[model samples]
Target: MRFPFARVVSLVVAVALLLSAVSGFFALFTARWRVASLPGTQQVANHTFTEQIIVGEYRTCVTLRRETPATNDSDVVQVRREENCYNTFPVNLFWSSRLRDVSTGEKAYFIGVCWINRDRVARVLGIPEDVPMQSLWKRQCFGVRSASVGTQAVAAAMAVIGGAVLIFDRNDKERPYRGMILIAGLTAALSLVPLVIWFGVVKKPGFDVGPSLRLAGFTWGIHLASFLALTLLHFCHSRSEMARYSGPPIDREVVTTQTADRLTPTQARAGQAAEGFARLESQA
Candidate 1:
């Protein structure tokens, strides 16, 4: 029997998409985005301290290390470290954000925790309540948080749907569906748009500058892999369709009958030779 290479490839693509989608979905819950060590000097009775901040889509961790002189004459210092990890509320803030339709000037309010008015994040981070925050930060949060969470969710869902479609379409290669490539392409687009939006909003040169901030983290990489896998799956379907349609069609049943007919004469000649040998043996 012939090896089912095409079926194997199709199944492999499906599995790749499923794995990528699962990773992408879980990446949303992790916090490994921007990692930095911020050093500061404070005149607290002749002591200095430094801080490290690690930020991510869903979480943030801060570590403060205080260094004090061990001895007045010694060059060594004693170190004290404190670390705490907390969940970021970007998506939560976005949920509380008011919605407005620009075209119709219609406005609707969401009933949830008022993150801005409550301002618990600043307090949690030890920022003074009297300090004013830039209005631009809210806008940035709206754009970055909304796109990161919303688009990733859509992309992951689309990828899962695409994987299921590929699995179901594997057996119908002889009469391939015309919509397979279209669905696969749409799935790729679903993954691609989120990546583009994320890059544009959060990863901009002007917005994301400085040594403390980074372009992306593991979540974005997972999304990229999901997009690439879906794109390759789309191309696979397209190539299969092109190969199936490009050549002249042949009837397998008719070809098999013709091959058997061509072999009949040879089979008859062999039978006659065997009969002659048997007659010679009988006569002897």
Candidate 2:
């Protein structure tokens, strides 16, 4: 009853954290789908160009069609297309890229294609020999893949830690849980890394940077909102707790009594004489 405001603020923070956690989980999976479904391969006047797309957290690849002269005697041209995504191995999650071709309306599956260290993980997974390895490590390692994973992981951790703190620590003394604040801050910070990489490092010639950057910004905004809301909630609860803990107001009567008790014997006698003189003068 003393800190009713603290209790209310803590309850609100807890509810917000719970909702954030639930929504963050869904957003993680949705982000994977959205990134994977980005239009990678496009046809323009007999030339098909594909941009290196980051599908999910751990996979990155590019697909392009190559044209070559069929025979030396004749002037006939042959079209060769290498349209398959790669898994990059050692960090493979549950999801894989199964992109469909826009022009031919055919589906291309690149489930177990390993680029780096193929002999190590490929043999263990028992992937068929037909799956080719398109190991373009120089271009694929643009740091966005790892940054995306880091951001998502931090966001999930923030949600969990914030929710726990809000539920257990209902009365904030001066600040929220230091650990929760640290985690939320880290989540907000990590969310910006991918956006920076997208605009600065990954936006190269022939790459579709618009849609990818937009998606990254959207996810980053969610993390930032969570961080700000949790911070405000903590501040409100802390102020309420401080008010509750502060000492009660002093009583005027108690102050007068204490002052009289502390007076010297000479001062007490002089006060009595002054009172008697005042009474005598009133009578005269």
| Candidate topping TM-score | 1
The residue pairs that clash in candidate 1, if any, are: none
TM-score of each: 0.54, 0.47
The residue ranges of model 2 lying beyond 4 angstroms of the native Cα positions read: 1-56, 60-84, 89-144, 172-175, 209-216, 233-284
TM-score of 1: 0.54
Query: Scored by CA lDDT, what does every candidate get?
Result: 0.51, 0.53
User: How well does model 1 score by local distance difference test?
Assistant: 0.51
lDDT of 2 by residue, 1-284 (tens): 36555456555655665665565555444323222222434432234444333433344444455456467787877766564444553345444556554345455544443333543332222222233322323333555556655676676667667667767764435345656666666766776776675556544333344444565566566657656765786777667768888675679988977898999999989988999999999999
